[model samples]
Target chain A: MNELFQKVLAENSILLFCYLIGSITFILGLKMLSHPASARKGNLVAAAGMLIAILATIFLYRTENMSHLGNYAWIFGGLLVGGVIGTLAAKKVQMTAMPEMVSLFNGTGGACAMLISMVEFNKIMEHHPEEMHRGHLLIIVLGAVIGTVSFAGSMIAWGKLAGKIKDKTIPGAQIINFLLFAGIIGLSIALVAGFATTLPVFYAILTLAAIYGILFVMPIGGADMPVVISLLNSFTGVAAAFGGFLYDNPVMLTGGILVGSAGTILTILMCNAMNRSLKNVLLGSFGGAKPGAAGAAKEGGGTYKEISMNDTATLMAYASKVLIIPGYGLAVAQAQHTCHELEKVLEEKGVEVAYGIHPVAGRMPGHMNVLLAEADVLYEKLLEMEDANDQMSSTNVVLILGANDVVNPAAKDDPSSPIYGMPILEVEKAEHVIVNKRSMKPGYAGIENELFFRPKTSMLFGDAKKVLQELVTELKQM
Target chain B: MFQEFAAFFITNYRLITIVILSIFLGIEVISRVPSVLHTPLMSGANAIHGVVIIGAIIVMGSAEPNDFVALILGFLAVVLGTLNVVGGFVVTDRMLEMFGKKKPKK
Candidate 1:
């Protein structure tokens, strides 16, 4: 029996079993993740599969000569250090910073894939140059290129999201990006054709890819980050899938493909929600072009009315149904809790309150939902954009909380507007509209919200948290 | 030429089939996920790709003691891959936990 067990381990049968289990668990976990109730458990189930795969690899994985992989200290030490740092960062990150945090984590994944390609390339060159097949070279080159780009792009995205890096666009920037991408591809083809197999040539390809990645993301404005981040995420997944191909490992293959396709779908979904093509997002640099001169010119003569807090409170207090639309500003001011408090206060007054969440309301996709969830807002009260629009006609009051472009009439009515054709909240459909903002400044998209100048709309000027607090106080007294 | 291609396909049919099927399965499973769960779902998928840690471990284990570059690269890959795996899942769980916390009250 012991001999049979040894044989199984030596022949890699046990490792294969572990891989199969890991793959199955990954599929099941992802399927479970579709619904809210099982999403948490789904994550745990996937984590368990990863644990099994890792332990089995450490214990049972064998080299070509059937020797067990040595170097336990380095392996365990790396795992321990990384595990501790990762857990700490995840635990400490605030909800508002979640987009950057996801970018940072995804960047590390891309870096890991890049490093693996580098290590494997070195190993193949030094040990088995004769066995370097065309397929092997293709996988390595593709992995390195994609991995480096994803890594660099994600880091730039993280920086931009955290405000550490400013949006920078050079003269003829699109042409420059095109040239760099071409150079990387040109170098890769050279390597694959066996014309330039030297490390310097390969490294040159990587360097160009890194540059392209940086420049690719540097000029994208804040409003377009959801698409950029999602695209980078899929790039990382595809890079990892190349690693899976290199190793012919089932678990890695399935996981990588799963992420790649899912990320692709997510990117498309984000683009669809904004009603912009991915090409338009990349080329137009929709949000970063100096706030569109036309925006100022368009709203130049329009006047917006302001509402006092006393009247605002009274209006909401007596309203039959009030729909509250929250945006990045609400998260910036950390007013989700106060907003929820205001909701409760309004509810106590026998007023019906529901949150209208645009798909791209905050910095990232589904960002507003996470913020509201953190504030203990009941999930059912949060209505998506379409549902909110469906109820807009009957809503007695449409309260815009630190939100701007999402409710803009320009998206629908202004044909030449940069944000034209983008689906908005259609707050005009409601009987009354009140916008809360710091000032007349444009939103992240840098567009003047024409909705504010409409007859039924009135601006409530103040910080979202302060205004909400004052309104709560005013409502309680009423 | 056709015979050669067939031979190649016969050898790699399983992997090819897995790759193709997984793509369709991926699109099918999350086709109807509500927009609210998008963040957690994306984060969850990010964590899944951290399975690349297996590849990292394989390289690290198999490299010779004298191969410092390979060892170092392997070590870094392991660290980053672990970070991706651990961090991705933890952050996602944190987000999903918020979603789960208030459900019992409903």
Candidate 2:
């Protein structure tokens, strides 16, 4: 149409194209990630797209200026500071914290969204403070509100994972959350009505968002955090996408959509790990077994027969099929490699060894898998809850190696318990069950494992690593 | 890099889509037949995040007349990329730390 407009479009075409490509990469990469085998490639292709998108945007923006070398200097300084911190953190953070780190990154994205929206708002205010079109102004205000809330909310989620925020109910949490929501909404409405400006009400809304974030997450126990973390991550993405709308940026919209959808899907998966519906995860207090439930009531009554390492090794060495159910106990004792050593010794004796991993065995999803993977256990040797359970009943010996809640038969038998309907590894259903544990302190849910007292169940008391070591030594003699 | 392909990319996005889909699916289908070929999915993702460092480089290098908005975005990009780099290595370290550990008495 117009020559100048055409020139502007042409000048920025590469950025626009890069944004589109990055969006496509994000979409296809996530789809390919459905299967664990191709997930890495999917991640790579998507990351390439992200790099292209950001660089294109930055380069296009830089073309508008050429004389301010000091401005370039500041950008350089930011790079150096960020590069050192980010690289060092990534190099040092544990795999278990991957999900948390993801949350933190998502929070940072939200921060960008908030900062950009604020900058734009300030620019508009400085330029045309008196010419507020109520409708357009409303859009910007709404974007700022959503973006700011998402930023603070995601930050709170990150804090929870970083140990900056502790999980304890700050008395009257629900009442306070309700008040904050009402106050923020009222303030937002007042701003739109031209009765107030962000100068006063903005900070007030921010305080509410911060409190809401704290109150929202502090009530959720550590066990149910994955779902919460993923949910907040998606919130951050949505916030960024909204900020894009405020700036009229097509690339931001597309990238944000991909992140939002993928993050939401991850949240759903995390919920399923806990056998929880999205609604339940948000509104219900799930995970810990309620008092006087089956695990607690039967705690003192069940006859938990004990076994020595030698006897445990004898059974494992001779058994035709041995299923090892590993849990947080294994992680707590860091016995994964020793377990692998024991498995190898059994394999040498012509015994089949497979590890049974429950969906929510440890504090987070895939906790046991990472531990076992570090032990250099073959990926094929690890069976998911469904796969491992199908074969458990046919196995000769089911070794409950330091797992607690995952292999507990009480979960299957007790309907009144909190984790009642959650899917669990059927190590309890195996022909012979041998439990390794240090004490009967109950699991994180405070539930006694009925698998311990089953007629076939016998406790082998020792640290997971030491017990596995002793078992390996005994199996070597066999 | 693909200025010549721009026309094809604009007109036939399907061709690029098909090529990428085939490569990824090919690797995936191959893995299913042999479980030992478990794809290094996490490591691959780590590498992708690593590519952000290159993006950071570009952003830092190309800020000619330095748009404040672009500068801010670039600064954030570097931080994000570095976190991934350091965190990935740290996880590898801690995982390595877990090897050969024995369980204490239950």
Fnat values, one per model, are 0.73, 0.13
lDDT of 2 by residue, A213-283 (tens): 66677766655666676566556555555544444455445444444555565566666666678876665
Those runs of model 2 whose alpha carbons end farther than 4 Å from true positions after fitting are A1-7, A62-70, A133-166, A287-301, B1-106
Clashing pairs in 1: none
lDDT of 2 by residue, B2-106 (tens): 443354356445433433453344234323221111112222233222333433434444533435655665566556544543443344334323321322222
lDDT by residue (tens digit), candidate 1, B1-106: 3454466467667888988998888888778787778888888888888888988998899889989999999999999999999999999999999888777564
Number of the top TM-score candidate: 1
Candidate 1 local lDDT, A103-147, one digit each (tens): 998999899999999998888788888767766787889989999
Q: Against the true structure, whose DockQ is highest?
A: 1
